[model samples]
Target: MSLEVEEARIVIRAGPRRIFGIPTYLNMLGSVKMAPARYLAGVARAEGRPLYAEDPRLRRALEAICSECAAAEAGEGRAVSRAEVVEAYYNALAPQLLSLAPSIDSIVVPCYTGALGEAVARRAEESAPGVALIAVKLGEGGCSWADAVYTAQAVDERLKSLNLGPASLAAISAALKAAEELNLYSTLVVLTDGR
Candidate 1:
């Protein structure tokens, strides 16, 4: 499958001024479980490329698939440890995020894994310096890299209001709420998932 990341529209809300939405989840191949990062890692493993997953759940899933793929290939290749797959996924994301930086004051990211937020922040420092980084934690940890961090639960009610009821994905709602809180004329909110 093609590894090229796709772009989502910049959603501008009437009252929120420059709050734009970059829905990263649009790039997801199929189900929510098949997150872009997970898909990238899976493809890498299946192709006998070096990859690693730090999250226990993701690691377990990768291990199961990787073992099967390895056997299919008669164990010809080695799987490298370390977050290579995730890092590459984030690296693929940098260009898109950077493209939005010039037009916005800050970027709000939803952190499912802290690495996700950190990787974006690290990339911003180099290519989009001065643009603020705000992170909303959907899972746990992985938010220290952000200029500020808020928990998913803390923003749930506000998210509901913004989403016009119950929000299906915590990441998208949290991102919108966090951006609204910033009170900026323009903020780029990265919606990490759709479902």
Candidate 2:
């Protein structure tokens, strides 16, 4: 028996707000100093760089920050306002997103039902047309390793079947981070080579 393998290039895009329905805080944060310029520059520098998703130190720090934010937002019985939650999420992700943008072709978020998804989709279309913005359905309950494995497998199958190229896998690692963070149901995202 003989088997043939084909090769093509493709990119995977994913992240908070962009991929996980995390309530975008970038707009809210607004034009602060050289944020746009700085972030753009950062993205350029990161082009073709590897995703930071598997970094133990970064993951721990992100988790710790998210936990702290959740606690703060919880605020005993008061429960901070929705705006506060949005702000907290934004604060936590801005730096990373800006730094990773260049290497990321798109962000795939899981938003079963909410205006957040629509809003993000629109913004991505207008602000960064080159970058793809995808939304998908999320499973009930919490995220788990099983879900991640499933997502990875599905992606691998699609890539292999389509014979996509390395570019397709470019942002896969980063996208996985969003999947793990949001506990996505079915992973889905459309990405272009910025051509």
Candidate 3:
């Protein structure tokens, strides 16, 4: 399938007062910034491109879903965890990705609590046939050690199903270093949140 075509950048922004923001997924994403740019520019770049969000309803849906976080106002009277907030964001965005149906050639697991990270990977594949999915986890990031361990385990189990374009299992920084040394998956596709 021909992948979506565009140029973009995606960043996961954590508010000033919230969970410890982890850049765990950065090493992996930064690793392959060139190869995909040339070969699968459309698909890869599509992830990085800004979203047009023509549908008002979908835009509203996305905003609502992502904003529903474990982090509430000081007096919102709720105990929300980082995981809970990320999970809600993932759930909210899933439908948009589903409806957009960009011919996904690669899936980037950039940022999410462990549960949401795995969920995003699995959901991406389900939504796009013949999709390649890879994840990046920083040694010290937002999610807890327990969250990382469990998310890693779950992701390992699911990766077999995805058709990968590049294969490198290492820390984000190291993986990125190796990619710079060697040549591989060089593109950043921001699947969502480009507005």
lDDT of all predictions? 0.55, 0.33, 0.32
Better of 2 and 3 by TM-score: 3
Using lDDT, rank the candidates from best to worst.
1, 2, 3
1-195: candidate 1 lDDT, tens digit per residue: 011122544454536455666565453242222343455555675675644444444445444545442222323435433355446446667566777787887877766666656777878888888888887766655677888776654433333333221123344455556666766566777665442
TM-score list, all predictions:
0.63, 0.31, 0.33
Candidate 2 Cα RMSD after full superposition onto the native fold (Å): 15.0
Best-fitting candidate, scored by lDDT: 1
Error of 1 at 60 (Å): 11
- Give the per-residue lDDT digits (tens) of candidate 3, residues 155-182: 2323233222222222222223322333
Candidate closer to the true structure by TM-score (higher is better), 1 or 3: 1
Measured with C-alpha atoms, the lDDT of residue 43 in candidate 2 is 32
Better candidate by lDDT, 1 or 3: 1
Candidate 2 per-residue lDDT over residues 29-89, each given as its tens digit: 2212122223222332445221221223222332233322222222222232333322332
lDDT of 3: 0.32
